[model samples]
Target: MSVQFVGLKEINGPLVVLDNVSNVGYEEMVELVLEDGSVRTGRVVLLEDKKAVIQVFEGTRGLSLTNTKTRMLGHPMEIPLSTEILGRILSGSGKPIDGLGEIFAERSADINGKPINPVSRTYPRNYIRTGISSIDALMTLIRGQKLPIFSGSGMNHNKLAVQIVRQAKVTKDGGQPSDEKFCVVFAAMGVKNDVADYFKSSFEESGVLKNVVMFLNLSNDPIIERILTPRCALTVAEYLAFEHDMHVLVILTDMTSYAEALREFSSSKGEIPGRKGYPGYLYSDLASIYERAGIINGHKGSVTQIPILTMPNDDITHPVPDLTGYITEGQIVLDRSLDLMGTYPPVSVLPSLSRLMKDGIGEGYTRADHSALANQLFASYAKVQDARSLASVIGEEELSPIDKNYLEFGTYFERFFINQSFEEERTIDQTLDLGWKLLALLPREELDRLDSKLLDEHYHPEDARMFRGA
Candidate 1:
């Protein structure tokens, strides 16, 4: 038999307290029946002694303290899981909002998923190509890695995310494409209605909607739903990757919104605040989400995450990006300055890298020359910064010959290599070949990162002539 109680203790912003309740577990789902007999769903967020505080998913209004009835569902929140979830659009709480109706679940899973045992994790290897030159040639996203994109408000991270979804793919050794079943799980939290429409329309127009599962939580939705958006998305990803043997790429945009929702929830709970008024447990909470990404020991499918967060005022030290940098493999940073200069992706090379790139590229992977070429590009770009600094100090025409070459290389590298159009997708070979062409503008001695053999194979000083007049 189930236990039901009449609510009376207190009603506080999205929360309802039921005093003298027994045997209620935390995070257990609840049902609230109003005086009018309309039902609302909630979960137990707090428990002390015989008292349980339930957070209603729908806002708490129009409920009579005496007439409302509460019942515990005995389990944490779970979402339906099946292969059919693909090609579907869902609300933040995993409900179908596309008028497609309910999922015929093979099974359901807890949205707060079980952590993969560290000992059972397969070391991430190989790569998932984003088809953006700056990422593929430089940062190199390894399969099953949790790499983040650090951006700022009003930047084009949304457009970049759309482009990545359109072009990302897995490749075999030596840059051959893989035929493995691949799909994307995209979750957008606290986005405006138009922004939500933009994402849906973009994926549909690109003909990739059939391969994607989207969970959208608009800004007008309750904060509780915002908190559930990524969890539901990841739950679907885990189901696809571990159970169905699919390579699932999960892209979560504007994680800053999720963090802020947590803060708001914490404030409503009256918990002590930490840095910038965020809850102190913020790091662990973030880890719980980020750590969910990786490969299992025997599982052929993998889950790779590209979590995008906006740094407040472009401050990298903000708690959201600061903690994310610690948890993720590495980051792809977008630069406002580069954006202003007409760069489409605006990936700032110096601050962006994939920590797993070293193990994933070269030989059977991307290319044998990939590692050395990336190093030389980094070194040369560092020198470009120096040359620009000198030019700023003493004027451009008076700079040394080598410095002028660096200046020219910097301009072409930015214009041609980094500033690709949203519609352009480059192969790994094409990206590498472009890197070498830009490096050709520099003198031979400056190419210290590459050995003689690689330079002989890829270096063509004549390629520099194409940029001579420009």
Candidate 2:
């Protein structure tokens, strides 16, 4: 038998308070029956002193206190999982929206998945090539790593995200795709209809829709759904990676929107606000989502994450990105300044980093000189910035010839190295070789960070011209 309440004590934004309730567990699913015989689903979010607060997944637009009845389902929210989920488009609430009908699930699992034991976690290795020069040659993304992309509003992060999904590959030595299974799980939270359609059509046009699973929570959808979007997507990823043994790349975009939803819900509950009006448990809440990514011991597959969030006012100190920086492995920060310069995928390589980059590159994984070339590129770019600042203080003609060379290097570096078409995908070797090609524009003696042996083999200007000619 189930417990049914005749009426709600109070109705708040997306929340219904049931007073004098007993034995109601947190996160227990609830079903609301309206007078018109329509049913909606919700879950208990707060339980205290014989009172329970249920958050309805569907918006509470048509319900009234006298006409609404709530039933406790005695269980938490769970998503049906199966191999058939691939190629399907689902709503944030995990319902099929593609008109393909329901999936025959193998089993239902909790959306909030269990944390992997620390001892059971295998160190992440191997590289997932994103085909972007800035990412591949500099901040290399390793399998089982959680790297976030930080952007601001009006930036083209959506295009960048799609490009990564379209071009990313799992590769071993010689830049060949590994025999391991690879797939993508993309989730969009609080996005506009056009943005959602863009992702769907982009995947379909690229002919990779069969290997991608997409969950979309649109702007007009219930706010509660935004909170569940990434979790529902990751649940599918966890099912695919651990149970079916597939390398899954999970992309959750506009996490700032998700965070905003959290703030709205928290404000409704009247909880004590933390930094910038976010919840006090914000870090743990984000950790639960991000820490789900990794390679488990004895597992043949991995779950890598590229969570994208827009920084409010491009403020790195904002709570959303600030907390994310602590949780994620590293960040690929997009620059508005670069975008103004007409750069596609305008990645700011200076602040960007990949903590797991070293483990995934080198002799056996990528080229043997990959590390040396990346280090030298970073060092030389730093000098270019200095030279530009010096020229700004004094006239360019007053600067030394070496300073002028650095300025020229910066210009070409941004044009030829950092900027690339979204449709143009480069292999790791191409990215590394291009880095050397750009370095050849500078005096070879300035390349102090590169190994002497690598400089002799890959950095000669004569060889660059010969290779370009060939």
Candidate 3:
């Protein structure tokens, strides 16, 4: 038998407090029948003996305390899933908004997913190529790895993200597409309408829309719905990867907005705030999302995550990003200074890292020379920074000849190496070859990071001279 409660105890901001409720569990779904007979959805956020507080997905505005009735659904919030989800657009709360009609779901799953057992997990080793040289060659993205991109407001992380979606592919040794079913699951929480349209058009233009499933929660939507956006997307992803045997890439954007919604809700609930006025469970909350990504033992499919969050004033230590750094495998940080200088992607090479890069590259994966080439690039770029700082003090005209060469190298590093046309997709081989071509510009003695054998085969001063002249 189902129980209904009338005359709610209280109506807080986006929350309704019901008294004398029995057999209610945390996160269980709720229904509100207003006096006007319109229905609204909610979930149990906090529960006490015979008293349950529900956070309404649609804000509570017209509900009269005396007339409204609340019903507790026996199950938690769930999303319907099927292969029919691809090429479809859904609301933040998992409703179809694309006018395509409801999905004929094969089954439904709890939005609050189960944590994967650590003992049954397999380490991520497969490399996913994004066709961006800066990422593919330097900060490699491994399948089943949780790598967050740290960006500041006004940076071009959106452009970079779109390019990544368009170019991401599963490849075996020598860059051939692996025989795996690949799909993308994208969730946007609290983003502007224009931003959401841009993503839709970009994916459609690239012809990858058929392989994508998008959940959009705009800034104008109710604050409470933002909380369910990512969880809903991940739930579908888990179904595709674990049940359907499809490799999935899940992208959650503007996580800062999500965190803000969490803070607002926590404050309303009278929960004590932790760092920066965020809930103390922020770390556990993030882990629940990030830990869902990985390769499960005996499963052919995997889930890789690229969560994009804008740091408040570029502060990496903000509670949102700070907590994320602790749970994720590594981070891809975007440089505001580089963006100011007209660099596309504007990736901060030194600060960005991929912890699983070592396991994914080299030998039969990308290339045997991938390890050495990456090391040499990092070393040389570090030198370029040093040389630039020195020149700033002594003036480029007064610098030694070796320092001047480094100044020129830095220009090429940014222009030809890091910067690429948004429409152009480069292969791993092409990126590595371009690295050698740039390295050849430097004198042989300066390339100390390269082994003697690599230098003998790849170093061609004559070719470098001709290319530089041309």
Candidate 4:
């Protein structure tokens, strides 16, 4: 391939301005030769008057415009795809971060990616088992869905993510091949060594390493690399799911750091800001990553995403999670108060919802009554929370018999529903059975969302009478 030289015009913090570039798209990566004879990569961020602003990949630690020679790579960042990559470790930039020897790939594909045509898209229907009762019962992740976990700092979302990666599988009855039905791609951005060690240890102890691939960017790693982590992950997911015919689940943690990296790069180029000083193209940039999921027609394998983002200051309206909610299917929201109360998952079922749950659960996917049971359980638990607040104000003695019953349901909901562990894998049956156990302490007449038949089959009023008598 022939290359052209575009002399560097200026240099800034981790950024360079190259003059006379004919064809460089935004966010496209390029190659640069510094004065020290070192070759590094950079990305095109702006195009103005035949000059492009490029963000240095490894950072502008030792680079100068006077001696920097810019070589247009004529392409975007790509990821190496092969079965040999499974159980391997890589950096955020798609390089071997684990210090293992070079990986042999059957082929490599560009990570920038081509837009998936709507006509070529197939409706995602198959359910991916996450082994979390709160998710499997309520969210019911679809095979090709892009669902994100929105949580606050210090929550167990990371552990929950690891659990999902290890436990998420397509059951036998679901017609998925036992071999490829379960696989995971885990990527960590701005995470510490202990956290990475925990993930590695968890995967090792759980014996899911053979089916999992990890790409890690530690907290001390170059912040610029955070921008490439998810893209590399999505590229791997595409390869595994499409080329290898495997059901691949990709997990990205601390997307907030990724967004902040974007923000910093955008600011380095002096670009106009959007919401909270983020780029205006933030939505489209996020969409490019999220839209990679889904089952295409004629492809047996599928890619599913479970990106975990920590909401800043426990603010759901933060630009990162807020924009993510708009792009992805739905969110599994975590509660801080419940976490303080020692709940493991701390999933606030009331505010948290899965839009695709209806498509993946009930009738055939799970039990026939999963929808009604989850809905009624959510309703009863919400009422219990309300009663708890009332009891706090007026005292438990002032609460009516039914109010007291609701209070009991609330306590049971926390201990059974929210308080869960990564080692524990609960089925839909267990989730609903637990739901029934919670509802048994409540008056049956209050189950307005559930049908009479389902209530009779699942809910035992005699048990409620005994609880009331006690």
Best candidate according to lDDT = 1
Each candidate's lDDT (Cα)? 0.94, 0.92, 0.91, 0.82
Instruction: Write one digit per residue (lDDT tens) for candidate 4, span 1-470.
Output: 64656457888888888777776787676888877788998878778988888888788777775777777776677777788788888888888766678888787788776778889998877688777888887777888898898998888888888878777888544323255555789989989999989988898888898888888898888778888899888888888888778888889998998998889878887889999999999999899999998888888888888889999899999999999999999888999998898888888888788788787777667778888888887788788888889989999999999998887777766787767876898776777777776677766788899888988788875555543454
Clashing pairs in 3: none
Model 2 quality (TM-score): 0.98
Name the candidate, 1 or 4, with the larger lDDT value.
1
**What RMSD does each model have against the real structure?**
0.8, 1.7, 1.1, 2.5
Output the worst ten-in-a-row residue range by lDDT, candidate 1.
1-10
User: How many residue pairs clash in all the candidates, one count each?
Assistant: 0, 0, 0, 0
Ranking according to TM-score, highest score first:
1, 3, 2, 4
**Residue 37 local lDDT, model 4:** 84
Off by over 4 Å in 4: 4-7, 23-28, 172-180, 461-470
Query: What does the lDDT read for residue 250 in candidate 3?
Result: 95
Stretches off by above 4 angstroms in model 2 are 463-470
How many backbone overlaps does candidate 3 show? 0
Best candidate per TM-score, number?
A: 1
In order of appearance, the predictions have TM-scores of 0.99, 0.98, 0.98, 0.93
Better of 1 and 3 by lDDT: 1
What are the clashing pairs of model 1? none
